[model samples]
Target: MYEDGEYGRGLVPYLSDAMMNIGTKVTYQTVIYPSASDDWILAELYKLKTMQTRVFVVHALPDLASRLFKKVNEVGMMDEGYVWFITEGLTSQLHNLDHKEDLMQGVIGVKSFIRNSGKLFDFKKRWKREFRSLYPDDDETQLDTSGIRLYDTVFGLAMALEKTQKEKGDSAMDSEGTRALKGGSMLLQSIRNFRFDGLSGDFNICHGQLQSSAYEIVNIIGTGEKTIGFWSPKNGILKMLDNETKGIKPVMWPGDSPVIPKGWEIPVSNKNMLRVGVRIGGFDQFIDADIDPETHQVTMTGFCVDVFKAVVDALPYALKFEFVRFVSSDDKRPAGTFDDLVFNLSIGGYDAVVGDITILAYRSDRVAFTLPYTEAGVSLVVPIKDERKSAWIFLKPLEKELWITTGAFFIYTGLVVWVIEHRVNKEFRGAPHKQVGMLLYNSFSTLVYSHSKCLCTLLHIILSHMLFVWFIIC
Candidate 1:
């Protein structure tokens, strides 16, 4: 809806609440056209043309609405895929205005319902005759729904006054000698409880307000309008009065087409291109923007650029965008930091920012950010010294505990060998020192594979083979 000062701006909240009750989400963007200048209207219309929303609910004075419709038609917005809905203020006055058929061809509007009856037909004939006599030159003037409603209001008031006069005297004087209605409150109560089948359908006043039975849904076709449907509180939108079906009749939309519009589209015009801001002198691996000297066309590349392009490609509709180098306003060069870029975005400098921007809490408060495409963390690195300078460097290959464990295993193997071989194989006789020396020789010789003594028993041979395998492993 266009946010004019008088009507459209004030109805936004009520319209939002009504739509919300019906489970529909509505986002209102206000385009203010404060003056009647053509340039101001055209400028606001251009902004609307770039937006994705095609459905509009207009609530403005008849003069402003007429101007808006004429400009909209000139810009080709009255073509297919656009839907225009006007409220009762403009709809009730449409019958008296002689607007162009093409300008209002596919527009839809709602006004108070006036049921067809012999009494209503006769009233229209009398109204036309009287209006013609009063202003003969104004042939376009006709009785509208507002006139019918006014007639009902006047008739109901007259009936209430007549009942008031019967109950009490016509006038009562106060201490100041000023006359007033004898039963003022009684008259108000009578008016509030009044109900009658008037020219404008059923006129029932509830809670001191006139209750509408239904609203006529009209579509502008040729020079006049066609009743496409009716919207009642009990049954919602209905194609016919007799049926319970909940839908409008098929309408001949703008461009003379019968196909239903999708009600939204991505703007592809060059003037409506989406401006994407890129960080200018950042780390080149993440984002880089270059400008040609001759043609002045910007070329954006790097990891961040590829990611942004992929995201756009995944959308169901085509999005036209151009990458702009984000520069400082003072120097016209790259901005100092990401915070500066985000602040500019919040103030309407760019439509979107694409780069390696960190998701800080302060930055998030300014502009929305996408899910972080890279992992979040920090890493520490230390340098290693040369090992060739130390004589004990060989011990660095294994821990000190591993070296001690290896030596203990070697001594244990020597003892096991001596215990098994001493029973039979030791040349069958030997001194204590000689046996001890022989044990040392047998155990240590396995490491160099220089043992010449042969095993006489199977147990000794098995121990010797096990020691040999351990030697090879070491």
Candidate 2:
């Protein structure tokens, strides 16, 4: 056995038999703790420190013999940092006592530990000085896995059987025969090229991992349980220590797959999701028609939704929004668009403005606007020359001084009314809504004031007509 990889006191046979008592296997069945990461082991204890699993129960022992006897865990030892038994409840845990200052409570093991009564076990080697010997050139903290691969005994057996079968059929077991297979080094590639099942997953691997020897776990740990969803191929990646949050950063692994704990979700940062909202059911100016919702998002012909996809792709991140809305003219179908830029924004409309939005700014303070994604062509409106000349003069721009005078007059009158309300009615200054109402009422009433009530009423009615202004503009 190579140094740390050797089986210490595991020569005893009766101990292995005792472990089968706690956990029996069907087809060598045992639940693996997903990973053998030191952090992985400690973490499993947290949610189940008071509870117990075959793996957890085995890890609780003191002496190597005891732990070996309890070999009920479906996982391999993760460099043996801490072992604990729960017969003493959740307390009386074990760890590298040199780093762990509190050894007064539980029995400390320099090389090995055997409980006073309950069958607890200790470690194969003393960690306090053993670490110094393991890494003579560098500190223990600098230790890294230069070559590692997470192994699956089940997969190994399957591969061995496959080799055995292929050799029997044609006596081809070496790479020479491997090269004869159509697709390259990858078993997935070979499977796709040929029609034979070897390993990895069912139906021959195509997209993901292959059965190349380049991917192999250095360790073959056995227990009685099957772990799922975790089997990292040995590739270069950073890693962490046994659940230690302090002074730790990403460490690279060269060969074996690092074990991840079962049931622990991988942590991920809150990434932005691409969002896009369309003016669904709004006026579509392209073909000049409103969208009808009774039709599915696809067109009335059941072909496509609005050309919103095209427009959204053309838009910047501005296309994202909490709500999804799209607009399409009844005459035209949705235009498909594509983008490669990372988009993290959204789009949508505010409070029920079900009308049209032309090239004019709506509420100035409501939203921010970018330079137009598109441009409109210039338009010219010829000035009508009134032959009489008087009406045309008013339509032309006024003199600078005349404009200033009229603006000042409006400002002065407004200030006077404001001051009066502020002084005479404290409540007006506090709220001022009533004062504003009165000012508007008085100004309009004075605009159409007349000696005859009938004429005043008629003039007021005619001036307030919105259609009158519309007609004049037209």
Candidate 3:
């Protein structure tokens, strides 16, 4: 499911084509629901239930995903049989969104693997401090993954420009002034070949795009998430890092089950409804096997029955089913173990048994089982204690070193302008009051590009050079 937006629509073909090239046929339905509305999600889910498409690739914004998953959880649709795969767009922004973690439990996300490094951590600390200082009132001030990409992008452009600037010699502006920065093409080529260790990871450009093959597979559990595995174009999905031989990490799936879901069980193309042998007693909530006196046919209805019917309806093809009541010989109740009930399926007494059947090691010999809807696992729950919490959290958006660096640069700019402009202008030839004011104005005006009309030409020249420096800094 993708958002009903132009960008979302544009991405569909790329994804579809990629899958099709690998001989995988793709069929999809687009959903356009009101933002953050559970009612709209439920309506769409109802349709999905009838079509029996167990796996869903959701390409939506984080806000929409939160609402959709909340509805999915409410309707009991986030079971083992269901799968939700989010694209990079939603996955990258998820960590910065509000209460989104709780809504995306058990979801699998594909993201460009951002390796941790000292430089990256330092950048993050600076970003956090600067962001808070700049926007003290804003609650959501975290730097997103895209911001790091943007940083690398700007750094790449600057490096490229610096190289081109040197090769083209001092002033790139031609006599006509139209050839300013004449190496635009050369700069682009330089950027395309740029390589460096960036904050995110290795920043190698190949085929006009970043050359990274590693992707992290994250599983959202509780109010947080973790990396359960990794996927590389070269090695496919692996339980751990390719170099690490450690076993796969435990996955806390939806509904708190550690059991990894088998994507799908029964194929949807088959036409026949499975002959389901339902146990009649013990617990009626799972399935209640009853007989219709008038039709003399076995009938079943309850939680398990509803779930079975829902899954069958969700299938791509039509299915026909007949419920057969399991009558134990010699008594109304089953005379033997639950294995006896499952044995009927093996002997052709029934094609499948849909009820509260205990899954065990021995049961595997008789018949295959779909993913269990019920959750069973042990989990370690811990309370998070943030000792760093303080009233001065607003200062967290920029690092102290960055703040100091910015202040030092501001002072340096004022000193440089005084040295250059003091000899060239009458404004610099004044008393201490006017001289200091002029110096401060020259340094600060770069931010607002403001100056008196008398000094426009001089300021323009200075501002032009300042603009280039500002661009690199930004």
Candidate 4:
């Protein structure tokens, strides 16, 4: 993988872990760009072109990623046998990218999936009209996943507020005249429990987060992204949602090649021996380097050294390499620190580094570290204390908003029935106060099947059936 910035740094470890779990070994190389407009892009592209790995996972902001891809295309790295996969951060904003058709052609990307529905279609039409009116000059008004999620959020809040209003009337002020929603806690609870079939698929909130259902895998083709497949927790990768197939659809890869790239190959450059850097003074058990005076040949041994040799030997093809000791300027001792050794590898001083090198976040920014062979752990112990529970803890099972919503719906249903039956049924027709009393008594009494009133109007029966159907569907 070739990436840059903090996003790339954070993503590399997870990608490494996932690949390792699948019995695949991955190597990562960082592309350091001092700034967005740096002239080093072309040079960096050339350097990457000389490397053996053709498959690259890119994780950078849209601007930097776009520039990098442009340089990649200029250097002919987008040709056959090359593979590029971009993360959701860049892929989600594909519409904002300049010359994306040329820069991102045949690039594979994964983005949050938004299912198609009439609701989404209508919302898009209205959104496009309003967005165009506000920004007439801007052509990129198409809604993305972020926009869809934002819309869903606002819609959900509105629904929660509407329910709150029905349950507790308008917002009220305290004795100190501070305005607040009459049932603020209930409002928050309603928001957390809100669920809907929204533009962004099933909008369900759990543990204060909007749950993601699946990811849509897309391939950049011409002026748009082509949905090649989908990935979900339940199903791995499926070419069709209804199909149980385990792999993605055939991809139109870079250089328009239908054949899959092998991901890596031996560098074509004349340099044959891989320059492996070894720290000179690490613990002898992890690594040790020695030179024979008679033959003047360097021999490397120890745990790390043996493992490295075994890995290279197990490769499908022969890998010629020689261990190069990283020594001080005086040529008598090891380099300054492991940081110095990794920094040198970043600058092309070594093709790879092997020894008792600890993986640190700072060092990872400059170079990638392979999976550690050593077991690592850290534990912290803290004193535990007992505390008395709050008196309101009894309300914890169901949220306060759920209780309020239930009461509100009971009253609402009763009011609907009364409106339909008051004109025809004697039980519903009475003095204003008496009818109001009956409304409350019957509403609550229905929960215990203690209501004495009977539905005498056909409208009431039909409305009851409609409510039953609604409850069933919900």
> Which predicted model would earn the best TM-score?
1
Off by over 4 Å in 4: 1-20, 23-26, 29-34, 164-185, 269-474
Off by over 4 Å in 2: 1-363, 370-474
What tens digits encode model 2's per-residue C-alpha lDDT throughout 1-474?
Answer: 000122222322343566667673211211223224444444443433222121222222234323322222323332222232222111122221122222211111111011122211111124335667877886454111110111223344356456544645444335565635332234443333332322222222334443432211111112111111111224321122223233222211111224322311211232433443333333344323334678644322111223444554554222232233333455254222211010111123232221233423434234443334357577799998666668576645667886676556445444444454445444345446776764454333433443132223433454445234434433
Give residue 390's error in model 1 in angstroms.
64
2 or 3, which is superior by lDDT? Answer: 3
Better of 2 and 4 by lDDT: 4
| Candidates arranged by lDDT, highest first | 4, 1, 3, 2
Compared to the true structure, candidate 2 yields what TM-score? 0.16
Determine which window of 10 residues in candidate 3 has minimal summed lDDT: 450-459
lDDT of 1 by residue, 353-472 (tens): 899898899888889999888687887898889888889976677778877877776676666767767776755238988777766666666656634465655655766676767766
lDDT (Cα atoms) of all candidates against the true structure? 0.78, 0.32, 0.74, 0.80
Measured by lDDT, the strongest candidate is 4
Instruction: For candidate 4, give the lDDT of residue 95.
Output: 84
> Order of candidates by TM-score, top first?
1, 3, 4, 2
Candidate 3 local Cα displacement, residue 466, angstroms: 99
RMSD per model, one decimal: 11.7, 29.2, 39.6, 34.3
